[model samples]
Every structure is written in C-alpha cells, then in structure tokens.
Target: MSAVSESISRRVTLGYIASHYGFELEPRFADGVTVTSVADTPDSVRPGALYVLRDDEEPSWLSVAVSRGAYAVLVPPSMAASARSAGVPALLATPDKATLGALAADIAGTPANTMAVFVVCGVEDDEIQADVVRVADFLHMLGNPVGIVSASGSSSLERELDMSYPLGILDIQHLLAVCSEDGAAAMVISADSQTLRPGALEGVNVDVLGTIEQLDRGGSQRAFKETRQRYGFSIDEQKRLVTCTEESGWLAGQASASRDLQSQRRLSLAIAMAMDAGVRRSNIRNALRVSKEMR
Candidate 1:
C-alpha cells in the first residue's frame, strides 16, 4: 500500500508484556488477519483478528499448525531459543504496562474501567485534566452522577464539564463532571457517611484528599459546640441566636458556632492546608460556610 493509504488503513494492535519493551502487530493483510500467542485462548481469538502468541508452552511444530486462522505467531522472550530453533516469527521483549495502557487508550479512544486510577498532585491553578478524565470515565461506566464537594480548590472536572460553582467555592459542580445523577447522590452519602475529621477521606471518591478533612473539620454539630464554648457565648443563647440567624440567613452559622475548640482549630488548620494545597482563599471561605448545623 502507498504510504498515505497505509497510514489511513493501518490500525495498531500492540501487545505489551511488561511496562517497558513490546512489539506492535504489523498487519501484512488488509483483511485484519494476524497471529498471536497461545496464552490468548480460543475464545479470545477472533476470526479476522491478529493473535500474537508468547512462547510459554509450545510443542512448536503442532502449536504453529493448530492456530487455525492465525496468520502468524509470536514467540515469547522466554522461548526465544525455542522460537529461533523453530524459525518462528517471535518478538523477544517486554513493555511498560502504564505506557502501553496509555498508548492503548489513545488508539482505542477509551480506557478500561479496571485500570481506572487517579493521581492528584498538589492543587495548582493549572488544570489537571488527565485525572478528571479518568474520574469522568469511571463514573460514566458505573452509571453514577457526580457530587461536588465545596472546597478551596478549583475542579478541573468542573471545567471539563463546563460547569461552575457559585459562592466562589468548589461545589457539587465538580462531582457532576465525574459522575452522573445517581453517582453524585452516592458521593454525598459517602462523604457524610463518616464523622468529620482531619485527613479523613473514607468514602468520598474525590481526587482532593484534603476535601474530606475540610468537610470533617467543618462538620456543624460538633464544630458549633466547640466554637461557642471557646468564644464564651451562652450555649443555649447561641443556639437560639444561630437558629434565628438560620431563619433569616447564614444557615450554617449555628453549626459554625456550635463546634468545639478542637473542631474549630481543625477547621482553621484545614483551611490553611487547603490554601497550601493551592486552594483559593475565596473558595475556602465559601466552603467553610456550607454546613448542616443551621438549626
């Protein structure tokens, strides 16, 4: 085939052994017929597909003839000697799994759910698109909706979804991008499932590990009691005041006031951590105000 036609017609079906060293199946035929290893069972072998067999178990002469539709066979690196002795077209190498996976995703237009993993570095204003994409794909596969957790950080996922959180804090908008409606509901329940605490990301499926800590520290019922005690406000009167405030506005005021000294301290510490983690100050403040302690 001409270079241009070859480029257009050729599709890659590379088989990687490890994370590093491997080979791409070069199709010699236009009919999508190729050969592979015996490790790939008969069920996996498609009629028109290429099968590259590694040379783990081989009665060489018979193995070659038995691969009915296989146009060729790949000998494993372990069986390089046997393959060379048998004069089989065997590739002798391994490849990086991560790199191979990345390439596979690029070629296949989608990634597998089993390999869905995320790595979140420190929060930078710069978008972390890769992580968001993985999250989005995973949630979509599970038929779940996203749930945004208010935090002092920008959500790359939210941006990818073209949604924005109001009140200058990261809201459920981020979750919306990663998961669908049902998924988001699951996330909310998961986040609230555990009691609030520092560095507590028990069930929350967020990339930002600190958001859990922030939510825990900001938990209203415990936080309000502590804050009121430290500020020397009358617990009953403060409760009434917070209730009245809730009726007017500032629904989280009561919860914010009710927290104990430790809780408030943890909240402050969490804010500082979020700031250090690259969360914006405005977002941090807004997140601090979202609470269920209003009454």
Candidate 2:
C-alpha cells in the first residue's frame, strides 16, 4: 500500500503541526525511502520512514521527527522549544491554539485544507484545550479522521491505533464491504450517506452510467436507444418496446405514465427484497415511500 494509505490505517499517530510563519526550511538531504517507526527519542529515527513519537522528557524525538527530511514531528511545548532552538522548522507544541492553526497551515500548504494528525498520547489539560477542538474541526472539515490517544488508556483507542495503517486487519472488513455487490454504490453512499439524495444516486456509479448514456446518444438515429442506454436494460427488448410504443403514439403516452407506475412498483419490490435481506421493515418502507416521491 502507499505511504498515505498505510498511514491512514493507524488510528492514532504522533506528528506535529508545523508553524509556517516563522521559518523557511530547505531540505538538507533526501532519504529516498519510506519507513514506519515508533520511537521514544531521536535514536528511534529511520531516515526514510514516518515516525510516531512516544512521550519522553528529553524531547529528542521532536528533533528527529522534523529533521532529515522527516514528514512531521510531535512534541510537547518544552521539547518543541528545544527543537526550534536547534533549527527544526516543522515543530508543533501540544495544546496551543494559535500554534496549531499556524502549524496546520504549514503542513497542508494551503490555508483551507487543514489536515490533522492524531496523537497517541494525551495532551496536558486536554479537557479544556481549544487546540484539540481545532484539530478535530480541521480534520472534520477535510473529511479526514484524526484519532488522538487519551491518557485514559482506552482499549478502543489502542485498537484503533493498531489498525490505522493501510490494509490493516481491522480495515479488511471495510475494504471487503466496499469491494462487494453494490460496492461502488456503497462507497459513494457510505462516504456521505447522511446527505445522499435520489438525484445523487446517478452519481453512485457515474462511470458506468455515463458510458451507457454515451452509447444512447449515438450519431445515427437508432431505435430502442433510450432503453438500451439505461442501466439494467438490454438493447433488443428496448428496441421492441420503442417500436411498439411508436406504433400507437396516443396510447404510448398513457403507457409512459403506466411505465412510471411500474417503475415505482419495481422499486418497491427492491425495497421489499432489501427488507428480506435483514434491513428493518420500517427503514425499507420509509425508503420505498421516499423513492416513490423522488420518482
């Protein structure tokens, strides 16, 4: 898996929010590799890897996390100070509001897309920290998930951290679900399921539907074009329907109205099938009612 994907699999990670305003950094060396490491101090550093910093008194990890072309560094204020003094450009201190905003901007390279880094260890006075809220908001706005480690030592958090990397065992079920039947639809709907509308259903598998539409709008005048172009319909049968409908234009209009009714029936049938597949009857019923109105 790619480094970004791998990084995403981990629930809680340690990285700093760099302050952009203070310093201009130039790469001292290019490691030409990607590594994943977790360390308590500078010695835990790998030249080309992403490192997670463990809480330590010395703050040596801060220097290493930011140095040698590292992706980011995580440190408390005391350690961040020392790292800054040592010329670590991308250092971020815990629980600092103004600093996190400045640091988030630096990491993302744009003011709008503030990315978040989840810290495995809890910050001091996290209960009242506005920076944590900002971090959550920033991640949320970007539709990114950031899992921070709390001092509570919650097992849930620990499980999340272990599986946050790409293709981790914990994420396999999600991956499989996305790759299954209606998987493409599942992906689109699941991503923004709360906001999905019937109109947006066409977007669920846009590439597939778009190709069908392109075939319908052929250069030559062809019969049965619309039906053949629609999803889940075949060309010959579509042609026959069109031919029959055209033979009786007046009756075809009435038939068109009936066709809509039939489509609603089919949709209702689909909902019933879903209900049979273990969806709650109420949900299926509501969905069918909503689909009818949408139609």
Candidate 3:
C-alpha cells in the first residue's frame, strides 16, 4: 500500500482505497467506480474525488461532493452502513481506529528509511536558521534536494521549493508519505517553537524525534552530518574525518579533503548532516559545495 515504489494498477477503484485502509466495500458499491483523485475533506473535494469523511461530522457537503461528481466516499463503519443501506457508494471501517496512523504511514512509506526530522534550538532566531530564506539558503548550500515545511510564509522556500508544506502542519503520517516518493533523498522539516519546545514532541515517535543537533558549522559548512553508529563519520580527528555513522560513510569518506580548511570543515559537516537527514548518498556530493557562509 506504499504511495511510492509500490506498483499501482491502472483504473483506480473504491475497492483500492478501501482495502488499503482495512475496510470492506459493501455489495452495492462492491464493484466500485474509478477515482482520479482523493480529497480528504468535503470542502476540498473535486469532481471525481474520493472523499475521506472525517469522524461523524458528515456535513451536507458529503452529498455536495457526490453531487459534484465525486466517484465514491470512504468512511467509518457506522456511516458506511447507513450509506450502503441507502444505496450511497460508501465503504466502512471502525470509527477512530488505532490503525489509522499505521495505515497513513504505510501508504506514505517508512520515515526511518526515507525521512529526517530535526529540532534545532539553543540559539537566537538570528543566529540559527530562523527564517525560510536562511533555511532555503542553508539547504541549497547543503547540496541535497530538500523540502521545507514552514509555518510562517516568509522564506525563499515560500516562493518555490522541491516540496513544501504550509504552516508547518507536517506530521509523521504526512512526512512518511512525502519521503516515500522518488527523488526524495531527504525531507528536512523546520522546527518551530511549538515543535522544538518541551512537551511539544511528547507523543511523537522517538525514532522520528531522534535529533541531530549541535551543529558546530562555522563559516562555510553551517555543516550537516548524520549519526547512525560509532566510527562512521569521515572527519579526521581535529580536522580528520572520524565519527562515521551509517550515513557519514558516503563519498568513500572524501568529506575530509579540501584546500580551504574552512570549506573542508563546512562541507564535511554538511555532507554528514545531509546524509543523516536522509539525503541520498548520490546527491550528497553535489550539495557539498559551500554556497554561502552563515551571516
């Protein structure tokens, strides 16, 4: 049920979304009409959209989506049974199911393999990547294709980005989905006061919350690095590539060699951070070029 790398059959049907969500389509809608797109809420519904109705809030909008030519409706069991009995094309699953997160992540892809979440703090907004422009600038210098999920729409990322999430509304469920896509080397989500502060990440997965902070990036690198295990990073001791993580072994450990000591240090840190952040190894080399020093 993965959204990426999973072979999708042509001719999407209601049965598809149903089976993916652990639901059974009733006999009336068993055959199911095909769907071209999906709209999780009623207002966002488009013609031929598959409406994923939220908990009992069945506003009259469901009928509106259907009237506007939505192919089918996906809902929890109580509503589904009612709809089916009334001849509405709906499928059913339990209400407030625990498997919803698992289902969403399953379709989005495993975050562990494809995503990186960071929570950087301990500095003023000016000193750290405080805005989208600085964040995008930092990412560009890091040399890996990256996405920005921002709350305030002031970053260069606000204009254009490989992938963008507005208002920093990204969750593991959504993030896993983004990471499951092709060309997605890494998904670097911006941390805000809401996410970076205490108790913000109370219920979040530690694996996803497992952070890589303490960026000692100076001048060039404002560097990025990853940590998976001991003896993995390519940095030499006191200018030598030492600490190697699963991600730090990239480029055969060439992150240590550079003419400019500052550039070497920065690029080394950048490579490691990008890799740690889930940037693809192949893409890391290009991002290693120092673009600008942190101001």
User: RMSD of each candidate?
Assistant: 17.7, 19.4, 10.2
Q: Considering every candidate listed, which one attains the maximal TM-score? A: 3
lDDT of 2 by residue, 138-161 (tens): 222223333322222111211322
Compute the lDDT of residue 216 as modeled in candidate 3. Answer: 34
Error of 3 at 236 (Å): 27
Q: Local distance difference test, per candidate?
A: 0.30, 0.28, 0.41
Stronger candidate by lDDT (2 vs 3): 3
lDDT of 3 by residue, 232-292 (tens): 1122223311222444433424544545543333344444544544567656554433332
Best candidate per lDDT, number?
A: 3
Candidate 3 wrong stretches, greater than 4 Å: 1-11, 85-87, 95-136, 154-185, 191-272, 275-289, 292-295
Give TM-scores for every candidate, taking all chains together and pairing residue i with residue i. 0.29, 0.24, 0.51
Worst 10 residues of 2 by lDDT: 203-212
Off by over 4 Å in 2: 1-57, 63-69, 84-87, 96-295
Predicted structure 2, TM vs. truth:
0.24
Residue 234 lDDT, candidate 3, scale 0-100: 20
Ranking by TM-score: 3, 1, 2
lDDT of 3 at 155: 19
